[model samples]
Target chain A: MYDFSADIADCAQAVEAALDAYLVPDRLSGPGPAAIRIIDAMRHGSLKGGKRLRPLLVRQAAAVFGVAPGQALTAGLAVEAIHCYSLIHDDLPAMDDDDLRRGRPTVHKAFDEATAILAGDALLTHAFALLADPACHPDPSVRIGLVTELALGSGVGGMVGGQMRDIEGEAGGFSGNDIAIMQAMKTGALIRASVRMGALLGKADPEALAALTLYAEAAGRAFQLADDILDVVATPEAMGKATGKDAAMGKQTRVSQLGLDGARAELDATIAEAIAALTPFGPPAEALRATARFFATRQS
Target chain B: MYDFSADIADCAQAVEAALDAYLVPDRLSGPGPAAIRIIDAMRHGSLKGGKRLRPLLVRQAAAVFGVAPGQALTAGLAVEAIHCYSLIHDDLPAMDDDDLRRGRPTVHKAFDEATAILAGDALLTHAFALLADPACHPDPSVRIGLVTELALGSGVGGMVGGQMRDIEGEAGGFSGNDIAIMQAMKTGALIRASVRMGALLGKADPEALAALTLYAEAAGRAFQLADDILDVVATPEAMGKATGKDAAMGKQTRVSQLGLDGARAELDATIAEAIAALTPFGPPAEALRATARFFATRQS
Candidate 1:
């Protein structure tokens, strides 16, 4: 079995370092403190401790194709930055109104709302800049591929569109399919992008890419189902945020539409499907396989 | 002697077409209506008529290097999209608190604030996607250049940073230099990016690019100065948005710092310098020179 836990820790550390390196402007003539605060808030939102699953996914996917860890780390940072920005915006009073994230105050709670908003915007913008940097990839076409994929994953057609649907679902009217689609967009798109970007960076063969895409789709749904299940079963302290928010806000989720047992069954099937998608790659995809199993069983 | 008026109208129509072509997904399987509303809000904010001056600048600058209008237009739409998204976010109640934009209800007023925010986010994301698109430029490097330039121009280090300064400036006590820096970032960066993108798209020589850079800087300053002057002298009816916001908010502006006459003199001299930067290009820059002259004299 692949030591995914160690791999995740290593990937997280590298991504954090990459984020710090790229985010803190190396130029001596930086803007004043007021401007610096925005950067601070961005750092605060993005660098806060989390599972770093997205970047881990990127690195693992890249590993399957013999890509360098350092190069994969940079692309991973781009996806994580996008993910962090989305989290920041999602925590806004105009949205989820969450006060906590990852056992700390949400960005809006830690900083003021306006600063949080600006910080989120800045982070989102910086992700593209980071991907375009030569450090991310030698070939310009590779960089463009990463960027366009990310934009589709994070923009209106993907994450943002999913977010709007999420907000609309707060009134609790979504059917099972709608919930799946919303979850895919809001959370799954970036996760899917994470895997696909890594594969792209490694210049994976088309067949491998196709298999990975399938794996990502199944894995993404399993990840969301796991999250929904955690929301129902985990404690607020354990989860590092409010528990039962899905039920409280009447937000339709897999656990809500499907009973907890039903959701668990779906998660099992999805995880199985995710692993099956990787069957063509054999032992090289052990890390990714472990990841799907981890997501399905993860409590926090 | 170029009839810039006709050129401006032509540029606007062409950009509108490009934006429509790129933005409205021709695929019949578009997102559902709720997701479509977010797209609608984005289109509402971006597509509604304006001078399209930024795109016009991109087109004119591209013309300087014999770049195709279609390619330049794509890059121009990218910049215009960024500008529109900025305006939408700026008009939010948490930000500028304006209710009118282009003489129509702001996005937040027409749609809810959450929708407005998502729309702005989507638009910003889309701008990068447009630039990364192979259709924007044949060379991947050119697309990467455009993406990176647009990111820096629109992101925290540029426009967003400038906006923070703007918000901070509202409490008053800004030096003239501070105001200049803020304006350069807030409004000037994107304008400069527009000209630079067009030139880059056309593969202008380094010398020509350097000259255009100088011209862009001078013209950018002149553009902001003209805007400050308009804020003081123009009416809301004429300006389309609320006038005198700078003065009313106690925000520092060129006109506020320099007084009307001093600001006007600065504008005239800046316009002269902007035109002079194109001296190396001779009559080929007539359109650009006319643009500077127009900014100096336009009432709105």
Candidate 2:
């Protein structure tokens, strides 16, 4: 097995630096002075933390198809922006209402609720602008394609819609299928999009893209299962977030349905499926294969 | 003076229909069963609503360069989606805390606050997806251009940034120029983008686009001034929203700084400036001229 830990750390560092450059308050010195406050809030929410797992997937998947690193990094940043914005909103008082994210005060806790909301909104808006900019891709077609993919992954039928379902499920009555669908939309959609977008950047042929799609779907499921497992077994100190939250909130999850041993078995199988789907690209997919294994076994 | 009232109503109807078609819960029948709740919330917040002013501007502006009505309407609805999402988020308890909008319960009031937030997020995402879609235009460049324009107008330097300023102003230290810049961002950015999107659809040249920019800025100022004046004078019934909010919140506005008489005078001058900027395109700009006049004198 290839070691991908160093590769993950390097990608995370690159994403952090790029996010820093993008979230600066330079706009405050211009006509939009109010922008500095939200920019500050955005930086607080996005900078210096997180696994950058989605961006690393983008870089690794694009590498398999031989896409330029710069182009993949730009698209990855856009995906990260969406991911960061979703976390900010999810942690708001009206949503998950968590006080800590990445082991620090959440955006609303650090600033104010109003600033947090605006910061999330700004980051979401910024993602589209970043994708639409010529710097994202020299060809307008690619830029528009990226925008479409992102919006589909994040919009009504995807992440936000899944969030609505999750909130509704708090009152109980969610089945195993409901849990799967909700998890897919809430977390899996963006993860799938991260890989698909990388393949897009590479302009992979239809069969190659289809194989990547299969790989991403399995990866997305395995990632969510890991999160569910972490929610049950990890300590708050290790997770940087409260653990046992699913039980505390009485939220329905795969672990709740399948039992601990069964869920672990499923996760191992999911990881194998993810790695198997990447077999088409052989050595080019070695990093993707390592990343899939990493998803199921990582503590946080 | 040319009468655009009938044209305005007709365009508004077209936009309403388009919004209805786009926001249906058909996705509920497919893989995303959770999508219906947000879709319903989106419909509740958007359908049979306000004057559809932004979409109206897009249609009229696109009409100036002989663009197809269908293309212009598509672009206009994208702008309106941004407008709708901004309103939904702005009415959150953490923000303006408005319980009523357009004389009905706000999304947060009608649905839960969580649903309202997701609905707003969904709407914002939907707008970009609509623009990036192939149905938006035959030319990918045109679609990408609309995305760039909409993002710039709605992102941090524009509408959402202005919202932060307005929230900060509730503590009351805004100078007159501060009010102008903030209003330009909060309300004017989307307005400017509305017309510019229309021009983009028509492939307007640099000089003509410049003229439209001038017209839009003046029109934007005039529209906000009229709104400020209306807040002072209109009844709750007439406005379909609570009147006297600016004063009650102690928020600064043009009317707060300049006496009502002064604000009205400025509005008249702004309207005139907007009309004068249209001199470059004689009869082609008659509807835009009427829209400027309508913005200053509208009761609601």
- Name the top lDDT candidate: 2
In model 1, what lDDT does residue A173 have?
76
Model 1 alpha-carbon miss at residue B65, Å: 0.7
Q: Once superposed on the true structure, which residue ranges of model 2 sit more than 4 Å away at CA?
A: A1-3, A27-34, B27-34
Best by TM-score: 2
Model 1 chain B is weakest, by summed lDDT over 10 consecutive residues, at B25-34
Clashing pairs in 1: none
Please give the TM-score that candidate 2 achieves against the real structure.
0.97
At residue A261, candidate 1 shows an lDDT of: 98
| Docking model 2 quality class | medium
Compute the lDDT of residue B261 as modeled in candidate 2: 98
Candidate 1 regions with alpha-carbon error over 4 angstroms: A27-34, B25-34
Identify the leading candidate in terms of DockQ: 2
Tens digits of per-residue lDDT, candidate 1, A1-300, equal: 568778888888887776776667552012222267678888899884788899898988998998867878878888888889888888988888889998899988887877788888888888898898898899999999999889888877578888988877775578657877887888788888999999999899899999999999899999999989998899998998899987887777777777999999999999999999999988878999999999987879
Taken over the whole model, the C-alpha lDDT of each candidate is 0.83, 0.87
